[model samples]
Target chain A: MSVITREEVAHLARLSRLALADEELDHFAAQLDQIVGAVARVAEVATADIPPSSHALPLENVFRPDEVRPSLTPDQALSGAPAVEDDRFRVPRILGEEA
Target chain B: MSLIHESAAELGRLMAAGEVSAVEVAQAHLDRIAEVEPKVHAFLHVDPEAVLVQARAVDERRAAGEELGPLAGVPIAHKDVFTTVDMPTTAGSKILEGWRPPYDATVTRRLREAGLVILGKTNLDEFAMGSSTENSAYGPTHNPWDLSRIPGGSSGGASASVAAYQAPLSTGTDTGGSIRQPAAVTGIVGMKPTYGGSSRYGLIAFASSLDTPGPFARTVLDAALLHEAFSGHDPMDSTSIAKPVPPVVEAARQADVAGLRVGVVKEFGGEGYQPGVLARFREAVDLLESLGAKVVEVSCPSFEYALPAYYLIAPSECSSNLARFDAMRYGLRVGDDGTRSAEEVMALTRAAGFGPEVKRRIMLGTYALSSGYYDAYYGSAQKVRTLIARDFDAAFHQVDVLVSPTTPTTAFPIGERADDPMAMYLADLCTIPSNLAGNAAISVPCGLADEDGLPVGLQIMAPVLGDDRCYRVGAAVEKAFESRWGGPLLKEAPAL
Candidate 1:
């Protein structure tokens, strides 16, 4: 069985928001399939009992006093924005036609 | 004075003693960059005026009697991945081509506070996803050793800057051998400090858990000095460890491996390793024994799967981390001419912006983490992470540190592995295990490979906070090899 098919790669591209070209779809399908086949070997050694390790160090929620501190000015915050209006980031419409 | 050739420590001392002004030292390096940058293409951005400005400030501070750090007046190259408020901070991705960040990364801030002159931002593999810098959207940085070969990467430019004498020191981040592999092929010292030992506050994330900023220098003590300057806890990054920076500089100065138990990873060498790389690695191990260190071979069976597990884990994290570049905020936005929706523009921009390798990994992570295959791919890879850590724990129980060839081969021809992802991935084989376990590892130039006449590196790995052990062992190897060869291995590099 193929690890990932061409159609599946197209679906993944959509899910990942990458508008790949037709040739890129074909190229990536073959490469991703090969990589998947090689990397799937981890399952062989990962017995059911072994707990997964998401990160190497322990992660904990940190807290600080609610006092405010100095921060980037509005000009600095929006400096890198592609578009800005009213000192905020501007983006294309987010809603659907119905909304 | 040969300012460009002097180590960071020497540069600092000379400036402190008023023997050399920071501007003069900076000018020498700027001149060197002008002479070499055209051939090597190590830097993504270099403003000679800006460097001299920073250098002059350092000189003035010293004149005012401020007690600056040991590396106070040294010139250092910053990796492009770190955000710099004053300069364009593109992570070698066209998506961020001309973007200027609003604030500095903690590493960048620390470098400035320490008075290290910012030489410029160096090139890297785009979003730090590739083993060789060929994936850099700008262009590949050619190796100084051979213009036809890769300099090793994602931190290729960092290693090459020091290797080519463009800069005495540079900074790099190692997620999976980005620092060590490049340093290995380039004949320099690169250390990946323990995962949280260095701050990740404003480092553009690749794999948040794995990305670690570290120092690259021509000598072990120089690397140690840079390491201590930028490392320690940062509250901004929750993952940052709250502890004193390890005594790595002192360990490098100590340079003793007497009675230390060194373990040669049994699974790393042979079969797939290049003959010359393996030969130099063995000689370094033997030299360690000769220096009064006890050497033994230890088995880490799970290490065989580190590369595969790493492929899955890093990409999975990258998929999440890179999601922040959705074409809405800072960076190259496209297709938003009122007709297309934000979603369409994001898709169009990402496709137009990311290189083939970055796109491939994002899609691979999407596939790995998708509903049906999650257990088989990403989940299993996480399990293997535990197994690999267990392997390290077992080995550490028997040895003070582990040693291996930093990589499987020397600098390969640039185009050789560009089309072959697996072949390119093999370049990071031996250095990935340490990343997976969140341990400290350093790559010090051992010698040149006989076959290709290119540099090779011996990797030294220690447990989580035992960052000092890597410096101790690396410094010993550096001292021994320097004496045996009558100079550093980099001295053997053909002059550009």
Candidate 2:
């Protein structure tokens, strides 16, 4: 199997949204290559027509009754929050806003 | 009470009779931990003061003539994957380092109700993703037997702690053999309860469908005592079985193998297994026959593909289950340059939060589940899963239980498979099929490998929900074998 190429690592990093240090990229490339190569063996038999089985048990519709039950209060939910403001978890804005 | 090595049932008897105070039992384990932990590295955290507090509470309740739980005053460590209300549960990942859950997992709540004192969270693979505990963002834990070797993984820390006698009992979760493999390498007893037998409401998800929480201890009956305390129905987990918990403890005590139909899998006893492991497994099978149990060879043909299919399906579910760790809700976040797109920040946060192995799984999962690849990848893997299950059903019809080498080999040096990912994944071949089939399995130390003198695990597996059978037959086999070996394998483990 081909080793994970630098371009492939860069693409995967982009997909994973990781900002890899220049020094670490080479090491990760080798590790990712080995892992992907090992896992990629699934392709040999994973042909079309077989429905994927995500769960081992065959049971379906594992839903709880939609009864309104107790829930963690905002304080409890956010108790371990690193940053919070106005009863909401605070985070950097996703879409850039007007300064 | 200094005989903390006594089975949990024995300890409970003494505690109930007021022969030993819970505080004294807890203190002895605390002192034992102090002497052993630096060498074992089994624990990520140890709160002796908190342990004492819980033990004292158990003592007070017993003093007041109140009903106490079975494991009262027993000290146990939990794998970091189980969320605890009082202790920080990081799931052995840096992303959630020092993050404490607002509520305890069902297993933790059950442990508390049983009056067991929580020693602290033990180490594990990061997010329980890898086979060896080496993948933990925290430093790797060394095996107690050979300080330079591994104690097997994901539940490595829990197994190591028990093997090193830092704690008498501990809790571990198995997904792809985490509990069993670790116990095998560490020379302790570990079991994966039937799927949904133990609630997974609070276990951090790696592969949600496969994760099953169970117990690890020094002896079969101790594992039985711990399992009795933890296994039950939980409203919080949809998959939690509402049926009465099986009588595993009683079965262990019965320890009857007479007339028990034991099936030895044809596929598992083949090439790639260490010679010592093969010999030990053969001896175990022979012992069962001598004890009046009929041993027959059975075949699960589709199991050969189980490891490959599991790799795909586990990662696919993992990719989806772990998507919640995006920087927005919980866990760490990283951002540079105050101005950035929401999408950009999400990416940066994920990149920073996930370790290499986690990212690798996520990427592979994402790739598998991607629209075009789903049919070819995840789809076929699932069909193979059905085939694997069918193969198991066919075998179960012919035998009451199956046996194999828990792992292909005993413990190797820490870095042996670090760079060889395929080799690492192969270590779990014998154990993976049990998880894929959602059956109950246990790994008890059969003997030490002749070559390295490292521990080797003899695995016992049963049909889905055939948990009691595994314990029943396992206890009998262990009794017969340990007598010849002189004692439990871990008892000879070097004092750390």
Candidate 3:
């Protein structure tokens, strides 16, 4: 089993969407190396013939009836909001790219 | 009243008879919280007033001579991950700290309908990521058995509260070993009903496929009653099993090991496990044999790969599941002067909101799912998952149940393995496969580890939807060992 490296850790952080500090990077790097080393054993025995599984049971088209039902009013929905504006639950602009 | 220590069944009987008020039961738990919470650190948020209000409503209903479910008037706390309208569902993470959900999770709703008094929300590892409660951003919950040692998590606080007598029953969600491991350390009964047995409508996601919500309590029957209340389909969760929850309380009382076939997984019972754990486990198996259960060695050869496969699959899903925490949604927001972009705001919020363990998982998950690596990492991990499931399927045909040590050893000292992530990950080795297979499992206090005198749990697992069987076998074995020991293990633990 190979140890995880700093670049791999950095790449993972980018994928995860969090910016880590310089101090936290080295600590996580070593930690990840150990964890990955332990978990890497699966690759040895996982053969090509086996189809990967995601869920234990197969479920198909499990949807609820689409009917309007009483839901929390907008005020109730936004009751826990730290900030709001124009009766809408205010959030920072979610889609950062100009649309 | 001292009935705070009474079983959920006893409380229900008292409430139905109008001999003890629901409010009285709720108040006793609230008082217990005030008395023991400092040392146990079990609750994240508790509303004494709200608990009393809910209790009084149950009392009023009973005073009017209305029908009630088995858990009515029984006080219970939920793990912080389960959403509750009356309190913030933090999931022990700063990302959603102080955020109250718009609606209660279906499990929480079911408990409310059953008139189970809502005591509070308990602590857990942030995002339920770690085996030990040490990963909790709030603070590690001290095992009631030995205050300096960790209460195994991510359901640490749930088990701790019950063990500490802060509440008689609590809810816990196990992904890997969260529920069972904590139960082992705290000397309580925790059962992860078959995956999808309990609805996940409002439980903040943590590896969605593996997550299971279950019950924690002082006895098998108590856990069975609370589990019965929540184990059924909810329109909100597609994965929820459509089957009605089997009568677990009846199973617990009628539990018999006579002629039962139990498989001792060869992969689990071996070295790397502490000697004390081995000794206690051997004795537990012997006791099972004495009770007339046919115990034999069985191997799920693929389990050797379970830990690795789980790490990959769990992180991949967690990365996707946790994306909802971007500051733009409903939680803490930071950064962004209008001149700066929203992207910057999300970065800052996430960085500030999440702790090290959460960040590590998100990063690892993201890496596993990234385009170039997806086929190599997540894809291969999923394949391993298939093999693990097949292994379980093969083993079950030969045995009615599988048994193993809940953890490699008993509770470890705080900070002992926190810095060593691999050692910490190994803590869930025996517990991870059940989640992968969606099997029902329970960890009941079997005996104390000979070395530390700390508790060792005997984990019993059964086929999916065979939840009542776990209780039947577990209750029988628990009685066999508990009777010999004279009482529950925690009763003998040095007072905190």
User: Candidate 1 or 3, higher lDDT?
Assistant: 1
Ranking by lDDT: 1, 3, 2
Expressed between 0 and 1, the share of native interface contacts present in candidate 2 is: 0.51
Global lDDT of each candidate: 0.93, 0.83, 0.86
Which candidate number would show the highest TM-score if scored against the true structure? 1
> What's the distance in Å from true for residue B420, model 2?
2.2
Q: In model 2, which regions exceed 4 Å deviation?
A: A1-5, A22-52, A62-65, A97-99
Runs in model 3 deviating more than 4 A are A1-4, A89-99
Q: After superposition, how far is residue A1 of candidate 3 from its true place, in Å?
A: 10
lDDT of 2 at A2: 54
**What ranking of all candidate models by DockQ puts the best one first?**
1, 3, 2
Q: Over the stretch B427-493, how does candidate 3's per-residue lDDT look in tens digits?
A: 8989999988888999998878878989888899999888999899889987887788787677787
Best-to-worst order by TM-score is: 1, 3, 2
The model with the greater TM-score, 1 or 3, is 1
lDDT of 2 by residue, B1-496 (tens): 2565777777888899888899988898889889878777888888888889999999999989999877888889889998898899898887898887999899999999889999999998889877778888888888989988888888989988888877889999999999999999888899999988999989898888899999998889889889989998888898888878889999999998999888998998668888998988898889989999989999887778888778878888888888787766667766735676656777777777777778777766766677876766677777787777878888888889899999998888898987666788887899998888789999988888888888888899988878898899889988988888887776777666
Model 3 chain B worst lDDT run, 10 consecutive residues: B336-345
Question: DockQ of each candidate's interface versus the true one?
Answer: 0.85, 0.50, 0.62
Instruction: Give me candidate 2's TM-score against the actual structure.
Output: 0.95
Per-residue lDDT of B318-401 in model 1, one digit per residue for the tens?
888889989987899989899888999999999999999999899888888989889999999999999999999999999999
Q: How accurate is candidate 2 locally (lDDT)?
A: 0.83
